[model samples]
Target: MPGRSHSGGVIRRLAPLALMPAGAFAVHQLRYWLAFAGRTGLLLQQQGHAYLHSVVPWIVLLAAIAVGVFLQALGRAFGGQCSLPRQTVSFGALWLICAASLVAIYIAQEFLEGLFVTGHPAGLAGIFGYGGWWSIPAAAAVGLVLAVSFHGAHRVLHAVADRRARPAVRVRGPARARAPRHVPAPALAPLADGWSGRGPPR
Candidate 1:
């Protein structure tokens, strides 16, 4: 596991994130069903009912994982095994991107679910009960345009950053132009008795 990488197992790796919520749901439902299976109803009488709301995000979590896995697979299968960005984004930008992506995926999911039966199946789609078709296409178009704009801005800013990172010519005043002067060393003092009191011997 020390040198392991997620790339080696694409779909196999995504399985956990994508299936966790479903698995949790299955277990939760199974517990309830089993509780009703007997007259005791011990499982249903269990506490922690307050935490039931916590499971609501499982669908959204699954959707986010699905989107990430799909994109990663797409990049690898054709885009040369692309990996996630190692750099961080601004807090606001990150929040906005995450919220927007989840909304998009949720909408698309609802649309797909509307098309097929109440069961599971591979698919794709979008939905809009109000504002007609205009709103649907408009949302998609706006998202696309924003994505393009963000990419362009990122590239331009990246180039500007690279340019500014290079060493620059810093001008200094005349007073500070010369190199620093060194301090003079202290002179040696006269020797005591032996050398000072007598002359040198042959």
Candidate 2:
């Protein structure tokens, strides 16, 4: 319970910070796809392509959830009673780490984009243009949402597992009848030469 309490507290405190990263990632991806579609006419030119591209963000989000579930299962199998809290902390940490990594990559991409300016560019600059300093906050928001969603899903899974594990059959037979079978004691052999039952063997 203490571990659960501590983990819950930490997640609550870090939720807002975590959301920034998740949101940033989501927005960045969304913008990238929209721009790509507009420039290439891929969405309009190809049947079903627009719809498929539109679902990319959802697919990515679901993948994140899958990762969370996998982590939760792993923790439960390995950590027993402390599984939930351990899983929650692990999921939160995963989001935080992912956000940090993306932020680093974004910065590097921005720098590279700036360095490679040319007259006949292929829109790499536009694709990597600075989306303002606000992307950091957006990324954090996304991460926060991911962590909270993972926690909620984890709790739901635990509840479902607990419900499914309840005993289905209850014993109600008579107590004496239900008692384990007992073997009768063997009849004692006739004592030798009038020896008493309490005395040691002759």
Candidate 3:
């Protein structure tokens, strides 16, 4: 029971913590951009492409792995058994969250750029351009798909685990029903002996 309870708690806690890597990666990217703004114009002009391509991806990858290890440790702590499928799901969810969060940040950056750099008129159109409005529906569709897929996968995992455990339960049932070695069995033993013609004297 404790194992089951602990596994449930682990799932609950790890699900939310799954978002941490993406969030941290985003913050790191933001910090890099901010620091870039402080560089000399010559350095900025020369190193912009290098910084984006080489440094950013590695930082994001490391952050993602760090978050993954943390979640795995939490899973182990709570007695949750990890398998390949479960790890895949966890990593898939992490990447999905990271992609979505980055898109959201980009959208925000678009609005900020328009307001501060382009001096756009403030309104709904400024927040999201007329064409950019489509992102809302696109994001909604993506979220729905991810949610349904995750729900189906979770159900399948539970079903498979239940099926695998069923055989063990069946195997243990007869063992439990077996008469205990320490239990006195005079009544049944005599019945067995009487049938076999080796019963005790009257």
Number of clashes in every candidate structure? 0, 20, 0
Most TM-score-accurate candidate: 2
lDDT of 3 by residue, 83-151 (tens): 323434554574466447645754675566456543443455543443445444444444444445445
If scored against the real structure, what TM-score would every candidate get? 0.26, 0.37, 0.35
Give lDDT tens digits, candidate 2, residues 76-177.
Answer: 434333234435367668678656755665555445544553321224443344233544655565556666765665566566555555656888877665
- Misplaced by over 4 Å in model 3 are 1-122, 168-202
lDDT of each: 0.45, 0.52, 0.48
For candidate 1, write residues 95-126 as lDDT tens digits. 35533553455455446544653432324322
Give the backbone clash total of model 2: 20
Angstrom error of the Cα, residue 81, model 3: value is 4.6
Clashing pairs in 3: none
lDDT of 1: 0.45
Candidate that beats the other on lDDT, 1 or 2, i.e. the better one: 2
Find the number of clashing residue pairs for candidate 1: 0
What is the overall TM-score of model 3 with all chains considered together? 0.35
On lDDT, the leading prediction is 2
What is candidate 2's TM-score against the reference? 0.37
User: Considering TM-score, which of the candidate structures 1 and 2 is the better prediction for this target?
Assistant: 2
